[model samples]
Target: MEVFKQHCQIAEEYHEVKKEIALLEERKKELLAKFEQAEKEKLDAAQLAREYEALAEENRTLKLAQSQCIEQLEKLRIQYQKRQGSS
Candidate 1:
């Protein structure tokens, strides 16, 4: 009778261990998915940062060109005014 009880106890322990292993496996899968999502977001953020830097450089170049054009326009206006005044 003791041997039968021991066998029963071992079987019960084995079932509990299996259940715990299954739960752990499911948790591992969830954590892996979260890690993959974080990695993708990191890559996307890096790409956006690069694009922002490129756009900022383009904006600076455009502003510099605009300033030069405005200066040229002012010079031309002054010359035109002088010629008209002489006439």
Candidate 2:
């Protein structure tokens, strides 16, 4: 009967749609996991950036201190030379 054939066709179409939906659900789960991974990487990168900045600031401060010490040593050497000349 034509009615039986139509019902069978509808059932087949329903099954096909169901299979597609199941595949989409799996894809959605995979995509969600990827999104989480990306967020974690971004957070890690930000933390590293902060640590790098702190290290750079410390290095700059150390360089400044080293320059001051060198300047003091040069001044002391000049004073010593003058004292020796006057003696």
Candidate 3:
């Protein structure tokens, strides 16, 4: 009878350990999913930053070109005025 009681106790302990292990595994999976989502968000943010930088550079280039064009127009106007005055 004592041996039977010991066997029952061991079995119960085994089941409890198994249940704990299953719970831990489930928690691990949840944490992994969250980690994956965070990594994806990080990558997305980095990509957006890169795209924003490229756009900023392009805007700078366009502004520089516009300024140069304005300067050229003014120079041409002055030259035209001088030629007209001479005539």
TM-score top scorer: 3
Q: Write the per-residue lDDT of candidate 2 for residues 23-42, one digit (tens) a residue.
A: 99999999999999999999
Give the Cα lDDT of each candidate: 1.00, 1.00, 1.00
Q: Report model 1's TM-score to 2 decimal places.
A: 0.83
Q: What is the lDDT of residue 35 in candidate 3?
A: 100
Candidate 2 local Cα displacement, residue 3, angstroms: 8.3
lDDT of 3 by residue, 1-87 (tens): 999999999999999999999999999999999999999999999999999999999999999999999999999999999999999
Q: After superposition, how far is residue 29 of candidate 1 from its true place, in Å?
A: 1.3
Instruction: Give candidate 2's TM-score.
Output: 0.71
Q: For residues 4-54, what per-residue lDDT tens digits would candidate 1 score against the true structure?
A: 999999999999999999999999999999999999999999999999999
lDDT of 3: 1.00
For candidate 3, list the clashing residue pairs, or say none. none
Cα misplacement distance, residue 48 of candidate 3 (Å) = 1.4
Better of 1 and 2 by TM-score: 1
Candidate scoring better on TM-score of 1 and 3: 3
Ranking by TM-score: 3, 1, 2
Q: What is the number of backbone collisions in each predicted candidate, taken in the order shown? A: 0, 0, 0
